[model samples]
Target: MPESIGPRDEGDTEPVRLPDGNLEHLDATVRQLLDQSAEQARQLDNLASAPAGSPFAGFPPGPAMPAPAPAPRPILELEGEEFESEVDTLTDWVETFLMDTYGDEVSTAAPWCLQWQEHEDVLAWLHALWLAYHQHKEPDAGLAGMAVWHRDFLTHTMAAVRAPGGSLSACMTDPDRPAHRILPGPQRSARRTGASTPDTGEAPA
Candidate 1:
């Protein structure tokens, strides 16, 4: 670096040695800068090469969209302890909330069984209702969730489940005259013999 320093042939040609730490740090800094510049240049090139009016043009890639939620499942598919557990929770919702609010006047037309859970059909319908109620109440269900439940799940299910000949009809047509019965299921053999062509498929009936 000084004029006094001679050519390699005439004097020492070894380069000035910096401290090991300082040299390593300087090398790392230079490499990092080069790598950053290269990345910026690649991004710019991508933008320039993008096709006009392309959805990807001039825009950075965004975060991936979340996976869709799973559809609700049937309650009857559960077995053993799982079936019992779900039914317990469903029973709580029915007694504490649903009945307290919507248990209308008992009559022959709109029958409601005092022991509705004993009816297999009632269990199925109420289980479906309970599942929908929870699904719509979730944050993902949006602001109209409860209203949707009332319309799509509640209103429709209530009408069908409480019809005069609905599942509960045989149980509690009149609360004052409460009774429970599971209508006899005809023997499968008899049913098939009669309905095989008769009960099942009548002659163009």
Candidate 2:
């Protein structure tokens, strides 16, 4: 009888093992193919959603918006001669601005006053007043009052008046009038009489 090499213990049920190197290479190829498909899908999605109004509707722009121009460096130091000259020019105007705005109340007993004539350093003093003026022009009375007060009192206390916080609001409020007292306007009367308040946010040009 021929050697019984025909019959094996395990029939066709056993799984065939692949070479380790071949299996690794196959896996790598499959991953690469999957990654390529994902990338292609992203590109399709981007193309479909391109905005019609944008300049780069089809593709990304080559360059982005240019950065803002660098701020100019200040030439004059706060206490320098150049700064003094600038302050001097502004002094006359500032003093006149206050006087014209408040008239006699600026002279009399008032919470806010600008005695521009009393200061020895007219230029610096004037600059201080101007700083105060700008500060008082704010919509918020508290902020404006704060700026003016800081500019007026703090300007004297400190050697330099470089930073005056409430000056803008100070300029806005009538120096003669307290912060609570609203200026004479139709709006004020309306509010007091339980009438409708008109749009007073923007003043006529």
Candidate 3:
């Protein structure tokens, strides 16, 4: 302890009373704090410089605070490298957690695609589901968060993706032979033009 601020003898229980309005008392308190701080710094320096295996040696440092959680990812809006990076992360989550855990038996009824990422519709649905998974898995999502996800989100999506005649119905029905195909979208036909001879024959009829 510094002589400037250490406790006095047994009889000196109370500090010397200073008048409230006095600047001298304030100056004294400040000087006392500075002296104590300097003494502490010196002690710390000495302890740090002490020989190995001293009582204070190898004292554990304070625990570091955990980093703040990252911002929520924006979905379906990324481009180029950013898009690809997000897809990579999504692929890992889908393969590791989604497919390994909840994957149903693959058959003509419950179709599964090996090349699901190539299908735009399947990609969009999975990405959306992936985003939702992250959201609900966080501490802030409450106790029943995962339950809500499974019921409201996962069940319906899996059904839609794997149902008979769904998007992946034509793909990967058998494990031994893999197949991938993007079903063509609906198209309208061009109107037919009537020939002059056809118009004359119609008039004659």
By lDDT, the best candidate is 1
lDDT of 2 by residue, 95-122 (tens): 5654465333421222232433223343
- lDDT of the structure predicted as candidate 1: 0.82
Model 1 shows how many backbone clashes? Answer: 2
- Per-prediction TM-score to the true structure, in the order listed: 0.56, 0.28, 0.58
> Candidate 2, which ten residues in sequence have the lowest lDDT sum?
161-170
lDDT of 3: 0.79
Alpha carbon deviation, residue 204, candidate 1 (Å):
21
Model 1 lDDT per residue over 10-88, tens place: 5658588899999999999999999999888877887888898787865556799999996756778878998788889
User: lDDT of each prediction vs. the true structure?
Assistant: 0.82, 0.49, 0.79
Off by over 4 Å in 3: 1-75, 188-205
lDDT of 3 at 99: 89
Clashing pairs in 1: 195-199, 195-200
lDDT of 3 at 153: 89
Q: Local error of candidate 2 at 156, Å?
A: 37
Q: Which candidate, 1 or 2, has the higher lDDT?
A: 1
Show model 1 residue runs off by greater than 4 Å: 1-72, 185-205
